[model samples]
Target: MVDEFLKWYFSQRPVLASQLGADGHDHTLGDFSAAGLTAREREEECWLDRLSRTETPTLDDAIDRDLVLSHLRGSIAMQSWPEWRRDPSAYLGPVFASMFNPFQQRLKPEPELVAAAISRLAEVPAVLAACRANLDPDLAAPLLVQRGLGQARTGRNFLTRTVPSMVEDPDLRARLAAAAEPAAAAFDDLVTFLEGFTCGGTWRMGEKLYSTLLRERELLGYGAAELHEKGRAAWAELDARMREVALRVNGTQDWRAAMETLMDDHPPTLEDMRAEYEAETLRARDFVRERELVTFPEGEECQVLPSAEYARPILAVAHYLAPPPLSSSRTGVFFVPYTPDGFTPEQVRQRLRTNCRAQMPSIAVHEAYPGHHWHLSYLAAGSRTARKVFRTPYFTEGWALYVEKMLHEQGYFDTPATELAHLDCRIFRAARIVVDTALHCEDMSIEQAEEFMATRASLSPGTAQGEVNRYCAWPTQAPSYLTGAIEIERIKESFTGTPREFHDRIAGSGGLPLGLAEQAALA
Candidate 1:
């Protein structure tokens, strides 16, 4: 039953299939039209019914069944919101991925990959037309529309310029270029649609649905109000810690001032900044091995690269993109953002300041090394399809955040500024939980959230705006980082084993929710 469901699921999500190195579906963009979604929902219901009735003979079988059930339930519950009907951004993700996965994952020969990309590109107009047909601008949130426009614009740039340059063979390049023109035009049409929208919809998910998602979908022990309170407490605790580290760094309790002082010592240019991050990635990997912090799977590798031009708007600083689990390559890309083409001088300064030297060590540890790349590598090697495909964001995001603090305690962060930077990051995540809940459940406006982030998290105004825009679009995701770390720490407190054993146990659990992962770890 599980196998049947997964096959159907992957069949309907070709973009996902491509990303996971699954072939045979790369030439198509899965259905997004109204009739298509209705058909999908009907099929989903059928699968859920069959899976619920199926019998499992062993403990492992039962666990797998439960995982599939959880994933199905979450998908059904979220269907109530009808994201495709309201958010234009909903369509952009798969649109971007359709080309991105085929281009990046070298699973096939270059010509074949380019052929797949061209096919997907040809489908772009139809996909955008479906987006227009399904989306009700009256139900769209203004901020969501605005951000979707930004993404559309950059996506157009990526297809026209970056994608063609990536092709080496002249024949394939010509084919890709021809296909890209219509695809780029599709993005422009999307941009026009979004710009014309006077979206009046509320971004709020409301207290009831938000709480339900926190408890049911996220598999969390607490609801929105409790999570918000926890976030406030965590923020306060981290803020106090930051002040102490700040005093050590600059002889003052003004943590923001200390952060400014550290920012002044950043790399001279974006290229230099990328070099610094590369060095830190290698350095942290070595430190982890020397300290026996966690186990590394054989042949694991991570490469630091500039952020893709299309993703820089949302990827304000740096992030990790895990390698395809089904691919032979174990290399993950760590993307560092560069200043965009039209950024004002001040905007460029903010972009550079956010990636400054003092923060690089902690960022490197969180996004690469024993954080995301290292943890995900273990799962890629050994996890079942159920675990690999169905992820709990808190566990994934939290584990990354957890390693930052864990390594700090292990003396990996040798400088006071680095420690200060780690604490500031913690505070930032904590603030995310607070701001996220406030925006979705407590009726905080976008402007207020941006202000809160800029002042409390010590983010630049532009960075704060981008962060808030993300929070608006993705309801519970922002809170996952800090909340996940907090949950993992709680789980650690109950373990009697060495740190490495505990870390390895949790890392090996794939993307299970914290509650399930804790049971697996402590059992």
Candidate 2:
């Protein structure tokens, strides 16, 4: 049915016709062949290439208008819904992505746009410098020129360029401007949001579009209190079980010491880390193929790559590949950081310990098993273009969260101490859920949120507060980690029969939405 609709839509829309102007500003498919086509060419070609492979039978104008309008309506409806009673801190995530992910701000010549943006080789350095400086009027402050990103001149300039493209119609403009007031007012409530980094640049003020964004990022329509409660209950259970296992593994010794001893017994050298990763990737591939766990189409293969700079920070422990363009054959990359400061000789040597060895297997499962790495690979294999192009954060983060603790029972983290670390992460994520709810809707202070995380999760004060700051700046995201995990857990437990059958049940079908994860497991 969808394919039939798509075919009809394609004929009506004639995306190619829309691109060409009536004045016959001739866009020669081959005329400027040597100089290469412009930016418009690249975008058109990218879309065309994707469409050509769709296997849709026909193209109709009604379908074209419907597709474009449907997407646009989804956007405008979020902003204009009256008495929507939505949260303010959750708005405009995709809007944020469009602004930050690449360059689209300025009127660059067609050929240089996306490439210029991705390289970050444009005047971004100057912009970063300016944003970090002690300027007279901060970008966070309300002003006529506050239409872009931060201090980075190029970043801000690019944001300005990109935003207009998403929202340009005059009627929609008047409605957006009118609806924006409440959201902007909500921003004033999140004071720490403005005092972002030590360098004086402001974080993205996406909290202004909080309501719609929250709905979009989170798959369900649940309230904050419900999410907070679910996370807290799950954390409590995981913590109790972890400590019990820790004591047993140490033969009644203290939990912390047991952890240290275990890590020392199974530590890996720096070189071993690389070899082990390659070994695991192959092992995972074999398991999927043998079990038929979501088939990867013939000729499709997943690859691993070294981490990049912007990604390196968050993925200090683990990372994965960025989506390649349609024409590219680059497989997904799984990256592990090798920072000398972080991975000292002593630290690397610790992996030789037995307990540490036990830990590596669980980490492997979290990174490569039925976890995100495999889930995404499955998605790509099934060719779910809409889900691929637009994935909800709840689903993405939830799948990863589910995989983290689930590895414990999978025979990966056998010893108790290593298991403690897994539980600790779960605890930290749980605290984030509470903090995410209280921080925004309940209007908790930074110190209060930090205190809650530190006490409940056993996190250092610095780590807790850093998390708090992230919540203040990012909003609603803190819950995604644990929220996703718990939902996955619920789905797993809801199964009526053996866990093996559960595994086989989900083997063929690709990733499912959180709302249906439980139902799918039962089916």
Candidate 3:
């Protein structure tokens, strides 16, 4: 039954299937038309009903059934807040990924990859047409529309320039260009369509839906009210720590001033910044190995690269992309954003400061090394398809955040400066919980959220804006960093084992919800 459901599931989301290394769907895009969405929702309901009726005879079978049910429920719930009918930016993911995934993977032959890209590229117009037909400008969020414009523009640039430049074969290049021309035109049409919306609806998820998602979808065991309070408390604790470290770093209790002093000590160029990240990643991996902190999966490699043009708008500073679990390649890419074109000198400096030397170690450890790359490698190496496909932010993001603290405790910081940077990051995570909750459930205005982040989280105005926009788009995810880590820490209190043993047990639990992860880890 699970296998049957997965086959049908992957068929509906070809881009996701491709990303997971599932074959036969690389040349298609997801259906977002109203009828298509209706069909999808109906199919999901069918699966939910069927899965709920099945009897589990073993513990593993029961767990697998629960995972499938959880995924179905989440998918069904998301349809209620339909991005296809609202956010014009929603369609850009599969549209861009359709071409990007095929081109980036090293496993496929060049000819096969180019053929897939061309097939997907030819469908781009149809996908964008779906976006046009499905989207109601009256329901569109103005902020999301604005973001869509930037993304579409960048995506158009990619289709015309970056993608064409990536091709090498003369015949394939000509075919790619032939397909790309229409795809680029589709993007231009998308941009024009998006520009017509001068008014928009609310982006808020509201209290009831937000709370339901926390309890049901995420299985996080807490609602927005309680999570908001937890965030406040976490922020307060981290604030106090930051002040103490600030006094040590620069003889002052004002951490913001101390941060300024440290920001000045950074790499000079983007090349230098990328190099610094590469070096820190290697150093962190060496430290983890020397300490035997956790089990390392053999043959996994992490590479540092610049963020793609279209992706930089959302990625902000950096992000980690895990390799496809079903693929033969064991390579993950850590993308660091280059300074965007047309930025003022001050904006460019702010970008550099965010990726500054003092902050790079924590960022490196969080995005690579024993954080995402290391933790995901274990899950990828596992034999279960359900485990490889069903990931929750609570486990994935939480484990990454937890390891930052773990490494700090294991004497990985090496200097007071790095410690201060780590604490500042902790403050930001705490602040995320607060801001994310407020924006979604507490009726906080986007402007207010941006200000709160800029002042409380000590983020630059530009960075704060981007962060708040993300929070508005992705409800209930920002808090996972801290809240999930707290759950892991709670699980740790009763376990008496080596740090490596405990880490290995939980980190390999298939990205389950915190509650289920505890049960699986302790079992």
Whole-model lDDT for model 3 versus the true structure? Answer: 0.84
lDDT values for all models: 0.83, 0.45, 0.84
TM-score of each: 0.97, 0.56, 0.97
- Give candidate 1 misplaced runs (Cα > 4 Å): none
Judge candidate 1 at residue 381 and give its lDDT.
84
* Residues 1-523, model 1: lDDT tens digits: 7877778989999888778766577888888899999789878878889999999996556667777777777777777777888887778888787776566656678988888888888888998999888887667778777777788888777897788778888888888888899989988888888788776886777777777777766678789999999999988988888888888999999999999888777777788889999999999999999999887888888989888777776668688777787667687888888867788878877877887788898899999979999988777886577777777888999999999999999998888988888888889999999999999986688899999999888689999998998888888989999889888999999999888899888778777777777777787
In terms of lDDT, model 2 sits at 0.45
| Model 3 lDDT per residue over 365-481, tens place | 999979999988878888778878888998888888899998999999978899999888888999999999999886588899999888887678888888898888778889989
Ranking by lDDT: 3, 1, 2
- In model 3, pairs of residues that clash are none
Off by over 4 Å in 2: 1-217, 251-306, 313-317, 322-330, 337-359, 404-407, 442-444, 447-455, 458-469, 492-513, 516-523
Candidate 1 lands at a TM-score of 0.97
In model 2, the Cα lDDT at residue 437 comes to 77
Q: Which has the greatest TM-score?
A: 3
